[model samples]
Target chain A: MRGDVQMRTMESSYSTKEVTKVPGWHGLVAWDLLFNNLTTGLFLFAAVGELALPGLLAPVAKAAYPVALVFLLTDLMLLVLDLGDPLRFHHMLRVFKPSSPMSLGTWSLTAYSLPLTLIVAIEAAQALNLLPAGSIVLEWVRKLAVVVGFLPAFGSLAYKGVLFSTSSQPGWKDARWLGGFVANSALMLGCAEMLAMSVLSGHSKAAASLRTVLMLLLLLNIIPAGLLFAEFHNTLSRLYRERQVYLALVLPFVGGTLIPLILLLVGDSAPGILGAVSLILLGSLAIRSLIIKIPHASREK
Target chain B: MVIRELELAGLPQASDPPIGPLSALLRRLTWPFRRGRAPQPHPATGFYTDTTVCIGCKACEVACKQWNQLAADGLNWSGNSYDNTAELSATSWRHVKFIEQFAANGRPTYPDHADSGAPSREVTLDQLLSGGGADRWLMMSDVCKHCVAAPCQHACPTGAIIYNEFANVYIQRDICNGCSYCIAACPFGVITRSDFDGHSHKCTLCYDRQRDGLVPACAKACPTASIQFGPVDELRDRARKRIEELHARGVPEAYLYGDEPGETYSELHSFYLLIDRPAIYGLPEAPFNPWLHLIGDYMRTIVSGLATVAAILAVLFLQGS
Candidate 1:
């Protein structure tokens, strides 16, 4: 019976001939996800950092909020660039669809942008001494930005995972753990970026703390990633069976995940940590692209 | 050969591209599709493509292209039999996929239909060694399934992909931002992004013609009546009777695909009658809509996401101060 099934499947060439790739969301979507998580990670890091390690993190995070805002704008820009007819971009805001993950994510991005901009504005004003640092009004505004920012942060953070998982793509379907996976990925990438930032500015003490956190994240990220891979094993394993796909993905794993992981584990050198951070960023971006690409791009005719 | 040599030498190979400014302008001027009768309302309709009777004429394919005025998929030979157009795409909306699994000359490279999941009808080596009619050529004039619960509709963040009154899944090109979300959302691989224009395209199920109370170009042009278009309910009934007739005629393998709703994937507005499993035609044995896990996916995110946040906090707390 199994052989018969195989024969029919082989005869049909069903695996090879189906609509191969997603029409357009390939390279740009990857960038969008990266930047999305990058922005989210920075903010989330600061949010947790303020409470967890107030002395070391509070001032730096305050400094990084502007950078996170920039990363977020780029993410939104990439989202616009990914559109088929970008001129018709305004149509996205015409509806408030809860059923569609993409719709919800877009709205979340929009919702989050306002508070994010305000947070940056407040930070910038205080930095430039436009507003008195201890003024009651500015403090209230800052608090408001943080409060208004909460729900949308959680919503935006998980939307991409749901967006990818709740699609008809073979590898993506039924992977309910994807939303959490996105969160984990964001944290991993965020920590890497922070470690890199600390090393660059010669904040060895800050780097030490960030390094430990990043190492822990890299270790634990395996759980959700492992589960996702197990869920996606059937599709991914099949894709990996193809020589071209195997070649395409191996680099991201080795350079992105493996090498950096080793460097972080053993090395305390600033340059080594920076190299690990850069490689992880590249590898992470590549892996995200591949995740989207593996299903959307057709290797076979 | 010269282009390859030049490319290998890292020299600019000046090959005249297929799509250049001159050709594009010429195509625009010579656009030949007739603007059919002014649009009007029609009932919910669909195509019942019976692959058993398809003769691979490709008249439907040509008619579809002519009526739609879609660009030719170029002169490249697929080297995969007469299926030069390949699968349905932004340009080639109606495609005839030719699955030629015939025995080469006299030797059978595949198993005989003995184990085809039906009644016991086994073939022996005696029959196989001899020149037997081991020809199992399948031709499906493929088009959009236009699913009842179209995943593309759910995936379209812009709400550009919608179900018309005819229940045909339609993409409003004007509103579409071409996010390609719908392209990924489709299980059948029907939607595609056009190279000419970045926007994704697929069969509109002849929405314009249907509105004008006319049968779609492909079904109308099918000489063998293999592609039948009519009200979906009536078509479903006809399909049932036809399948029964095929089964009674000793073709027990015949079955309807996407004719009914499954656990996750819903019914297809446009369906097919196949003599073999759907996989034989590059279709999944059981295609699922990712939207089925909509709530579950979000719920899982809450659990996983919160836990990760807590982990981040714990990690920071331990290392900080």
Candidate 2:
């Protein structure tokens, strides 16, 4: 919707200080950022499922990796398609620049795919009964997912936030709470996904447990979210005063999070939990798809 | 290794080393580039724009466009004096800003483009006749700053943006994947992604012309020698002398912008001399590089991730209980 934002001519000389939107970093960039975070959330879910609740949520554990793998691969394809030269996306692998968050992100993204794929392979082999019941390969893959996979999954969660903050864009410059906010939101996103899966599989116990964790996460996420809002309080007040912005950002996020959080806190029924998780999922998607646009949107006038 | 081979009189041996047939074929194919002549080091070069002398004829802009073969922007009435080119873009690298400080009735005004849909230049006969409410009309030809530590270079993921031998920030056209990170990272709003090719582009400081032992096209075509091109050190020295001369001549308001190392950003290699603050010329007063906060950003990420890990562990413990 914001794609038509023009690099408009200076209306007046005095307006130059606050105007001039840099063209590029369009909607596709926002979509990529959102998908990358979602994929990492799935990775975190699978990693935790395998390590902590193998017996209780073993089926959900088995399903999470493949879903994560699919999401990750799709996100990678979207990222390449978002580039100016899709065919030369491999050029990102040419160097290892720690100073550049994008450089580090590209490398970490590639590294993350390996352990995820390995876990998916082990899951596939087990599904086909290609190995014995107590196979060492199965155990090793699960353990590796915890040890090796955690690093990149966490890296994925963090890198996008670092990437945004380490740019000259105005809304992003003061994003001290961005990493925490994204990680916490994605954690809630992960719980919502797992809750849906467990509830569908008729694991009321797992669903209840996931619901409790989601409640805690929902409360925890407020710290970073509130801080992030406060960080932009001075710079973004003018932009936020518009009715469209309030409707687009504030209404959905507040309603999505608060309503579900309240429901989870008081209610324990399957239908209620399912409905709440749905709201959480929608809330995260709504916010993420528009978050990266804030910096550019501020200069639209 | 190549130098040692040449010094030891083993150049032939280095080129045709004893190897398997497959290895030999690979070696032969790569030998030319491996033994290529080393490049000569050159001094860091950039422009020293003294806006006081700018006539706003836009000869440098035309020269830049012609030499770079950049696509022309369609004619659009800017309503901001004679600055019709508007701003720098993927195509228009050199933009001459015409700051019309005076308006009709001598209001000392930069009149807002009113609710009227059409853009208007508000000069009236009264102010012109009375010679009242007159303010300085500042004209500056702005280009890429080519900062000593370029934020765009640091933000490029593909290693496409690199400093050439002259220490000018050069974008490798073939290597850039048009990620557009460089666009957002440039504090001066210099780089822009082209809709035509989907690649971000800015002034190369005429790396091609400099390689051929020629001055940048803009500097060469400048009518008033406003855009001076030379070694950065030489330009700084000249700027200091010019500043002293201006102050002596009672033009005390004149000072250099981007000439000295800034608190938040490095000294701009392509610096400027202006009579007013940088904000008046549409330049940031204190442009900050993202590099300054890069470490803090990463630390926040790691700390957030660690907090997440702890949260996850706590949840797991609660479930077990």
Best candidate according to TM-score: 2
Give the per-residue lDDT of model 2 (tens digit) for B158-178. Answer: 888988889889897767878
lDDT of each: 0.76, 0.77
The candidate 1 chain A region of ten consecutive residues with least summed lDDT is A1-10
- Identify the runs in model 2 with alpha carbons over 4 angstroms from their true place: A1-23, A131-133, A242-249, B1-38, B103-133
Candidate 2 backbone clash number: 0
Model 2 steric clash pairs: none
- What is the DockQ for all candidates, taken in turn? 0.43, 0.29
State the lDDT of candidate 1 residue by residue for A1-301, as single tens digits: 1133333544644435654355556788889999999988777776667546767876667666777789998998888888766756666776789898888888888898888889888878888898788889887787677668767876788899888887766677657677878888887877787777778777788788888888778777777876876686667666666675566656876887778889988888987898898998897787688777756544432
> Could you say which candidate leads in DockQ?
1
Error of 1 at B261 (Å): 1.4
Q: Chain A of model 2, TM-score against the native?
A: 0.88
